[model samples]
Target: MISSTAIAAPEIQHWQTKNGMDVYFVPAAELPMIDIRLTFAGGSAYDGDTPGLAKLTNAMMSQGADGMSADDISRSFEDVGAQFGQGSLRDMAFMSLRSLSAKEYLDPALDSFTKVLWKPDFPETDFKRLKKQTLIGLKAQLARPGSIATKAFYKAMYGDHPYAQPSSGTEESVTALSIPQLKKFYQKTFVAANGLIAMTGDIDKAKAKSLAERISSGLKKGEAAPKIPAVKRLEKSQRIVIPFPSKQAHVFIGSPGIERGHPDYFALYLANHPLGGAGLSSRLSKEVRDARGFVYSIYSYFSPMASAGPYIIGLQTRGSQVEEAVKVSIEEINKYLKSGPTDKELNESKKNITGGFPLRIASNSDIVQYLAVIGFYDMPLDYLDTFTSKIEAIDKPTLLDAYKRHVKPENFITVIVGGEQG
Candidate 1:
C-alpha cells in the first residue's frame, strides 16, 4: 500500500489567454517531453439536428487541414516523432499532442496542430469515405448485443435528451450530415473562449504561456456553447429486453446520476467502490459472478459529464441466466443502498483509492488529461492534492448519506439484449 506522504501533487499554474481561453500548466523538468491537450465544448450533446455532427467534425480535423492532405499531416508528425490524437466525448471534444520539448520538434508540430484546429479542409472525398465507414460501423453495431443494450439503455434513461443520442451517431443521422453542416458546427463550437488548454512537461511558464496563446489565436472568437439540459428524474422503472440470436445476454442497469463538481461527488465516488467499482472484489462481481457463476464479469460506475450522467451497472451472462442475473444484481444494489458499506469495506476502499492515487498522475500524459478535466469542469485547482484526504474523510455515515441522496433502486432503467422475451 502506498502512503499519503509518498504522493505529492504537481504545482498547477492557471491563467487565461488574451483570446479568453482557460489554461492550466504544470512545469516538470523531470523529462524532455511535453504533452498538450485542448478541450472544447463540441461534443455529441451539441450535435443539434445532426446527431453525429460533433464526432464527424472532430474526426475530420486531422484527415486534412489548411493546405495539407491527410498524408501530409501524418508525415509531418511522424517525421518529428510526435503523436497526435483527436476525440469527442459527451461533453467535450479534444485534440492532444506529445512531442520532444526541444523547440525544433515542438514548433513545427504546433503549427500543424493549430492548422488542423483552426482550418480543417473537410475534403469531400475524405468526408464521403468517412461517412460511408461510419454508416457501415453503425450497421455492424446494430447486430451486437452489447451495442444494442447500450444504445437502448441510454434512450430509456435519457428519453429524447441529447445524451440519448449515440456519440458516433445512427445510420440515418450520419448519412444526413453534410460538409456545410460539419463546417458550421465546427466554426460555432471550436472557438477560443469555448475551450481550455492543458500542458505538462519540461517547458517553463514563459514558453507554456506563449504555446497556449499560439494554440488558441487561430480559433474563431466565438462564445461557449449552450449548456446541456438537466436530466429529469425517472418517473417509473423500465425493464427493456431486446432480442438477439447470441447465446449471451448483455445487461445494463442505470439512471441519471450526479454531474461533475457536485458537492456529493466525492462521497459517492468512495461509496461506489465496494458496490461495483472495485473490480473482482466488488459486491456485484462476487454475488453475480463468483457466488452463482452467472456471468463472466460485472461492474458499476458513474460517467459524470458536464450535466448529470449515467450511473450504470453492467454485466453479461448466458441467455438463459438473464433473469436470474438481473435479480441478483438488483438485490445486491438494493442491499448496499439500504445498509451501506461496513467499516471494514469502507477502510479497504479508502486504502485502495488513496494508495492508488499516485499512479493516476505518474506521467506527463496523465497530468495533462487531469488538468484538462479540472479546467474543463471548473474543479478546484487543488483537486489532486486533496483527493486522498477527501476519500479518507468519507466515513460510513457520509457514504450512506451520499448513496441515499443519489441512487434510487426503484428508478433504475434496466436493458437486457439477447434475453428471453415475455
Candidate 2:
C-alpha cells in the first residue's frame, strides 16, 4: 500500500532553444542555489576509430577554455563557491555546475561553464600532462582483477560492437589519441542538435531560457547522432575464464537484456528487486551468500542503456568455490523464470519501492539528475510523478512474464577472472 500522503513529483518545464538544445527545468524557491547539467551526444560509443577520444576530449575541455588556464577557470568559480563537474559514459558526456542563485555568483559561474563546454581550448601543455595522467590511470586499472573481468565481460558480450569498448580507453588507444582527432570529434558530437540541459533550483523559466540560449548558440547546429544498433541476444551460454593470482575470482553472468524504452521496463524493474537489486534480502544474496556461504557477496541487475544493456549477476567467490557459485546463481535464476516472484515477495517489493520513491526527488540536486535522464532519453515529463503508481500496478503474473521475456538463464554468458576454477 502507498503512503497516506503521496509524494508529489516535481513539475518539469521543457523547451527547445533557438539552436535546438533541449532544456528541462524545475524551480525550487527554498534553495538559494541552482544546478545545471549539460549532456551531449559525445559518449564512449562515439569514439569511432579511437576508443578513448570522447572521454579524453571531455577531460581536456574541463582543464581550460577560451584561452583561460585551468587555474583561472577553477579559481574564478572557487571565489564564488561554485562547483563544476564533468564526465563521459557509454551513451553520453556531461558537465554540471552548481552556484548561488544570486547574480554575483550565477553570472560568473555560468560564463566559465558555458565557455569550457563549447570553446574548450585543449591547451597543449595541459593536454600532454592530462594524457600522461590518463595513461597512468589505465595502467593502474589493468593491474586489478576486477577491471580485467569488466573489460573481458563486455568484449565477450558485445563482440565487435561499438558498445563493447569501456568508457576509459585502453592504454594503446589513449596513447594514440591526438589533439586534431579530439577537435574533430568535438565539432560533430558537442552540437546544439545533440545536446540536452537539465536545471533545478532558484531559476525562473525566463532566466533558464536565456541561459539555455546563450550556451546553445555556441554549439554548431549540426544533426542529431544516429541511433545505436540493437544488441543481439546470445543463442547459447558461454563461459570465459581468465587466470589471475588473486585468491578470489570475480564471476559475472547473464545476457543482453532490455533497452531504455522496453515495453516491460517497469515490470522488469520491480521483479529485479527480489532477484538481486534489494541488497542483502535479494535472492542472489540469499542463495549464494546466506544459505550456502560460497561467495563474499552476490548481486544482479539489468542496465538499460541506448542499446539493450546487460542483465548481469556479479559475485566474487573463493577460487575453489567459483563453479559452485555460478551453478547456484544459474539455478536460482531458472527457478525465478519458471515461477516468478511469489505473491508475498511481489507485495513487499512494491511497498519497499514505493516507500522509498520520495527520496529520489527529495532535493533540488536530485531533481536535476532525474531531469537529465528524462531529457536525455526523451521520457515523458510525468515520469517521476507516475513512477510509484506504475510499480504498484504490476501483479505477480505480469512481473513473471516480464522477467521471463527479458532474462535468458539458459543462454547466460559468464566471465570469470582470477584464481583457477575447480
In terms of lDDT, the best-performing candidate is 1
lDDT of each: 0.90, 0.88
Candidate 2 residue pairs in clash (backbone atoms < 3 Å) = none
Error of 2 at 401 (Å): 0.8
Model 1 lDDT tens row, 1-422: 55874678997899999989999999989999999999998899998777889999999888899989999999999999999999998899999999998989999998898889989999999999999999999999988889999999998999889999999998888988999999888889889889999999998999999999899888777898888999898978999988888888899998999899999998999999989999999888888999999998999998898889999999988988888989999898889988998888888899888888888899999999999999999999999888988888878888899888889989899998985531
**Tens digit of per-residue lDDT, candidate 2, span 1-422:** 65813868888899999888899999888989999998987799888778999899999997889988999999988999999999999999999999999998899998999889779998889989988999898989877889999998998899888889977898889988889998888888899888898988887899888888987887888988987888888888888988888888988997888888777999999999998999999888988899999999888888988889998899999999998888988999899999888788888888888888898788887888899988888888998888999999888889888888888777888999996633
Model 1 poorest ten-residue lDDT run = 413-422
- Candidate 2 stretches greater than 4 Å from native: 1-5, 420-422
Give the TM-scores of the predictions, in the order they appear: 0.98, 0.97
